[model samples]
Target: MPDAVVIGAGPNGLVAANLLAYAGWSVEVLEAQPEPGGAVRSDRGVHPEYVSDLFSSFYPLAAVSPVLARFDLAAEGLRWSHAPSVVAHPLRDGRCALLERRVQETVSGLEAFASGDGAAWLNMYGMWSRVGSDLVQALFTPFPPVRPALRLAAKFRAAGGLRLARTLALPVRRLGDEEFRGDGGRLLLAGNALHADVAPEAAGSGAFGWLMSMVGQSHGFPVPVGGAGALTAALVSRLERSGGVLRCGERVASVAVRGGRAVGVRTAGGESVIARRAVLADTSAPVLYRELVDEEHLPGRLLRDLERFQWDFATFKVDWALTGPVPWTAAQAAGAGTVHVADGVDGLTRFASQIAMGQVPDEPFALFGQMTTADPSRSPAGTESAWSYTHVPQHITSDAGPDRITGRWDAAEQEAMADRIEAQVERFAPGFRTRILARRILAPTTLQAMDENLHNGAINNGTTALHQQAIFRPVPGTGRPETPVKGLYLASAAAHPGGGVHGAPGANAARAALGHCGLRTLLHRAQRI
Candidate 1:
């Protein structure tokens, strides 16, 4: 029996296991998949010579995450590579809005669109410079982050606290309209907002959009050298070095409970792994509550709250092994690792509105990735490994495009959707289709099949909407990792600070478990020494 059993070997699970193991608690991590990394894995599935990230590729969040930084993954054979430009949102008329790693460069570019827009961007960055670290620290730590929150509140008060809070709470669209006279600065915020499920008009979208934009400016969206799996490999290596155990293909069937507390888990093969101290689950909140644990052990309020759990939008992805780089009409886009394909802000609005109305938009706004540009090791010299993803409704009522795609993601529908996505790419990169040597389409069903936590193809665990976040996350009345059941912690993206490659949820769970024996405080003391 280990001191801690982490149910899932995804980044979160691995992080939790690593922390526990480092604290001298024997840890065991069980993963259902044949390999780990979950959404963070990569492969040469599209072509033998090209490495395509199966799901997530870029890691701006990971770059800034204090949780991941403590591990010093670079020492464990992890290397990060960045593109010349961070992101580019191009329009049909060859105009582009670009995000450069240097704040001044980004400001200079935005100034071209409107005179004061650059200042507006700089102003936001200034705010970020003041409170960004503490803001991010507050977000990553357990909810009700008392110290960081106080620090952040102090910083905000100096900058007109209530006024700043109102701006953060504004919708992305409204924020853009208020701040910029031209569309360039606005487009960057809105595009980044779409990276989550939030639409431009959605409340509180401004904060996320601004956060992502500032993070991109501060830390260029970087990819692991070689492939995304390298990051996972580093995490695994670090865990092993700390004496943690990883068991792949060991599907946890049920969490064993005794006296209203999690004791261990039973594998599908009838193997029992006992956790003397704690059981930390990196599975989806729904799966953990509905499937892994019996209903008899859960509080009635939790079950009722779970009923309203809303998943983010489903995703459709395309991976390509290109003969050459994407031929973009706007030269800036060619050097960008990630490109947002939409005509303009209005076009993005149309696409998002269609998804909101349960219709697949005719012109999908694709978040395109040039993996080779970001990391040369992803493919051969001069060749490109590329991918793009767009949001779709969980359930479809109509098709806003010609293909009439219903909710059923069959082969024909997948091809049609792929074609539509490619068409959007080709609009920006005219010769995009010609450059594709091979292509693979991952529909919603395909994504869910690949990773069960991406329930119904909804990424981010659940919606990033204001109503489902923070204290409201996973369920109401609880914001921390502790579940209603003692000795059980929710370490998945479904926890507060939802989704992204950041390892906060996992680290929080490990600390929570360490609290059982006052190890967390002792560990901090040791670290200070």
Candidate 2:
């Protein structure tokens, strides 16, 4: 029997398994998919020559995450590729707002829109830089992060800390309105916030926008040289070298519980793997609560809390093998790894509103990636492989609203929606359609089918709103990985620190298990002796 059985091979699952193995515990990882990485996989099947990331590509969080940094992935054949510019948002007037890797350069770019806006950008960046490292350490770790929190508080005096707290709690719209004097800075912040499900007006959205922008400025958004899967390959290599085992194509049907404790898991094929110490589930909260765990194992209140757990917006992604680069009117956009095409802040607001109202915007906000610009290895010479994605309401009905795709996400409907999204991109990148040699569209339904973790096409697993975060995550008062079941723990993105390529959730879960298994305590006692 292994010390633990991890029922998922996503970044979080793999991280937990590797940590346990490093701690002198025998760990086994089981993945439902043929390969690992979950939504972070890439493939060349879309076009025989071009490599396309099936889902997630960029890794801003991973670059700054302490947990991932400790792994030293570069030693395991993982090389990161960065573009000249971190992100570019093109306007209708043939101008683009570029967020460069340096704070001064980003400020200079913002000055073009408004005079005092440059100062505003610097002020925001300054705050982030001062507390950024400690904040990242604090937020990504387990809740009630005392030491990091105290460090951050000391870094900023009482008044400054209070003000910083207000900024973190502010919504994107409000934060932009208060800090920026021009559309340039405002649009950049809002676009970054929309990367998740939080709307511009939603509470606690300011943190997401500010963090992503500053992180991008500090470290240009990077991708693995070969593809996103390269990162996964490196992680798997590290795990194996640490004496861990990864078993793909093993679908865990249920987490076998005995006497109110998780003993092991039974696979869909009727194979049983006994876990002598712990059973960590890297699955959605609903699946773990409703499907994997029997009714007898769950508390009524916990079940109700899972029922009330909200999810992020459903996503629609399109990958293309292009003959050449995107023909953007704004020349600077061509050099950017990621591009945002929309009207402006109002455009993003309208897009969010439509999704909230269960209507798909006729002109949606699209996140376009110029993969080849970041890494030429993604395609042959003079060719490019790129992708774009946008969010929509989860439950779309046939008669949802005006300009909606009927919420069914069928093949014909998906194609029509893709056309709409292409039109949005074409507005900024004229003749964009002409550059495409082949295209693949993954609608919301298709996305859910591709990965079970993306329930209802929600790529983030669960909503990251203020109410659903921290101690309230998954459910109020159940923030830690240890669950109601004695030996079962939640280690997926559905847990705290939410989604991203960052491996905090997995590390936290492993820490919790190590405590229960007595290895961590034993090590502490031995060091003291």
Candidate 3:
């Protein structure tokens, strides 16, 4: 019997297994897919020469995650390559707003749109830089019991700690409008908030916008040396080196519980594995509670919470193998890792509203990524590999089926959506369509089928809204990883600090399990033993 059995070999699961192994426990990870990394995998099926990042590409959070920082991925063959400019939001006209790593340069670019807004932007960063590391450490670590945060707050009191508190509650739309006088600056901040499921008008979205903008300026949106898979490869290597065992192609059917305590798991293949210490589930709460555990075994309140679990907006992804670089009207756009293609704030708001109403927008707000431009090894020489993603409603109104997803779109419909996105890009990248060699489109349904973790293609696991955050996430009795069940823990994005490639959930789960087993002292003893 393994000391611990972690179900899933996604980044979080792998990280959990590694932490357990590091603690001197024999750890085994069971993954349903043939390969690991969950949504962080790369694929050549989209196009032969073009390597496509199936899900997440950029890694601003990973760059600063304390859990990841401890592992030192750079030594494990992970190389981060950044674009000259992190992101660019192109308007319908030829004008564009670019975010660069140099704070002064970014401020200078903002000055064209708003005179003093440049100074305002720098001031925001000044505050962020002063307390940003501490804030990130506090968030990405386990839930604070008011002590660590209070201590950090006291330390950073001179750096506008109270101002930061107010900033977190401010509506992103209002903050953007108040800080920047010009359309370019306001749209840039608004565009960053749209990266997640948060609406611009929502409170707590301002913090996300500010953090993303600051992180972009601090560490330009980075891609791995080869592809997104490089990051996964580094993680897997680190886990293996730390003595973590990964068993792929093994699907977990159920968590076996006795006396209201999880003890082991039954696999879909009818194999049973008992964990001597703990079981960490790096999957969605709905999957854990409804599918994996017996309904009769769960508390009445927990079952009710599962019934009310909210899903975020779905997404549609399009990948292209270009014959050459995207022909851009603005030369600066060619060097950007991320490009926001929409009219402006009004256009984005309209797009969001249309998505909420279950209708595809007439002019969708598309986020295009220049993968090969960020990392040349992603494609062949002289050609560019690119992909763009846009949000859509979670439920399919065209079909009233229980699955909530309609039939796959015909080729014409897929091409039409792709054309609409390209047309938006053409506003900045004039001759974009002329360079397309091959194209692949993935609807929200396709993404859900690819990774069930993307429930209804809700990429960030669950909604990023304020109500579901921090201690309230995934139904919040205990902010720690421990579930109501004694030996079970959540190690997925549905936990605190939410999604991105950060490994905090996994680390938190392992730490909690260690405490439950009284292995914290044993771990320390073994160090001397």
Candidate 4:
């Protein structure tokens, strides 16, 4: 029997297993997929010469994660690469709002839009500089993070506690309107906000937008040098180095619960593996509750609550092996690793509104990635490997556009949506389609097939909206990794701190398990006395 059994080889599960192994616990991570990496995988599917990130590419969150820092992935052969500019939003008029690595450069770029907007940008960065590191710590730790919370409370007091809270709580649109005179700062904030499913008009979007923008400013949205898989490879290597075992293609059938506690897991192959210490699940809450663990092992409240658990918007992606590069009308977009294609802030609002109404957006707001620009190793020389993703409603009731795209995501719908996305890209980068040597379309169902956690291509697993965050995440309960069942933990993005490449949920679960074991040992010693 291994000391612990991890039921996924995704970054979170790998991180949890690695931490346990590092602490001298024998660990085994079973992955359902043929290969690991979950949403962090990369492949040459677009072309044999191009490395296209299968799901996510950027590593800004990973760069700043204290949890990931413990493993020291850099020593395990993980190298990060950045583009000339972090992100760009091109206007139809050819003026682009760019976010550069240097704070002053970002400030200068914003100032071109309006005089005082530069100062506004500086002030936001100044706040991030003050609380950013501590904030990261607080975010990575489990909820009711006592020490970090106290430290942040002190810092928050100094930063005008209540006032700062109100400002951060403001809707991104309102925050933008209050801070900057022109579109530059607003576009940056709004575009970043859209990175999550949160709309600009949402209550907590300002904080999320500011957080992503600050993350980009502080850490220039780095990508793994070779491919996104390099980061996953580093994690796997570290886990193996520390004596952890990973078995891919081992689909966990059920959690073996002898009493009220989890004891081990049964695989799809009818193989039973014993976990003496704990079972850390890196799957979604729905999967864990409804499928893996039997209904008898769960509380009625949890089962009911799972019904209301909201998943973010379904994702539609198109990956391309460009012959040269995206021919952008706006020059700034060429150097950017990430380009946000939208008409304006109003256009973004319209897109979000359409999705909310359960309509296929007429014009999708594409988050386009220039992978080769960010990391040259992603493709052959002079050629670009690129992909763009846009949100569609989970259940489409109507088509806001003329294409009549229902959410069936059949070949016809898939092809139509891909064309629509390409058209959006073409809006900013004229003749973008001309450069595509090959393209791969990953519709919602296709994405889910590759990574089960990305249910319906909901990247974050659960919604990042304010109501579902913190203590309320996964379900309304203590925002810790520990579950109702003993010796089991929810160690996926479904837990507190929601989604990101950061392994906070896994690290939190590992720490919680360690603490439980320590406490149990202490109790046994006390009983003997």
Report, for every candidate in turn, its global Cα lDDT versus the true structure. 0.91, 0.88, 0.82, 0.92
Per-residue lDDT of candidate 2, residues 1-529 (tens digit): 8999999999899888878887878899999998898888999967989999998999999999888888888899999999888999999788788898788888998998889889999988888888889889888878888888898788777339688888888999999999988888988899899899999999989889999999998887999999999999999999999889999999999999999999999999999999999999889999999999998988999988777899999888899999998999988888889998889988888888888887777788999999999999999988789999988888764323345467777777888888888888999888999998999999887877778999867988899888888898888987788899999999998889889989888888988888887676643432221
- Distance from true position, residue 222, model 2, in Å? 0.8
RMSD of each: 1.3, 2.1, 3.1, 3.1
In candidate 1, position 238 carries an lDDT of 93
Which structure is stronger by lDDT: 1 or 2?
1
**Candidate 1: segments with Cα more than 4 A from true spot:** 523-529
Worst 10-residue lDDT window, candidate 1: 520-529
TM-score of every prediction relative to native = 0.98, 0.97, 0.94, 0.97
Model 1, position 156, has a per-residue lDDT of 94
Model 4, residue 322: distance off in Å is: 0.5
Q: Which whole-number lDDT from 0 to 100 does residue 358 have in model 1?
A: 94
lDDT of 1 by residue, 1-529 (tens): 8999999988999988888888888999999999998898999899999999999999999999988988899889999999999999987788899999898999999999999899999999999999999999999988888888999999999988999999999999999999999989999999999999998999999999999999999898999999989999999999999899999999999999999999999999999999999999999999999999999999999999999999999999999999998989988898999999998888888999999999998999999999999999899999999999999999899999999899799999999999999999998889889888999999999998888999778879999998988899988877799997899999999998889999999988888888866776655732321
Tens digit of per-residue lDDT, candidate 3, span 1-529: 9989999988899888877887788988999988899888888977777898988898888887777777778899988988788988876466678897788888888898778878988888888788788778778767863655875687577776676688767877888877788876677788998998887888888888888888888877888887888888887897788788889999999999998889999999999999988999999889998999898787899888767778888888888899998777656678788988887888778887777767766677889999988888889988888999888777645421122234355565566666777777777677888998888888777787777898767888888888787888887664578887889999999888788888888888888888778876854542221
Candidate 1 residue 16 C-alpha distance from true site, Å: 0.5
Off by over 4 Å in 2: 397-404, 521-529
Against the true structure, candidate 2 reaches a TM-score of 0.97
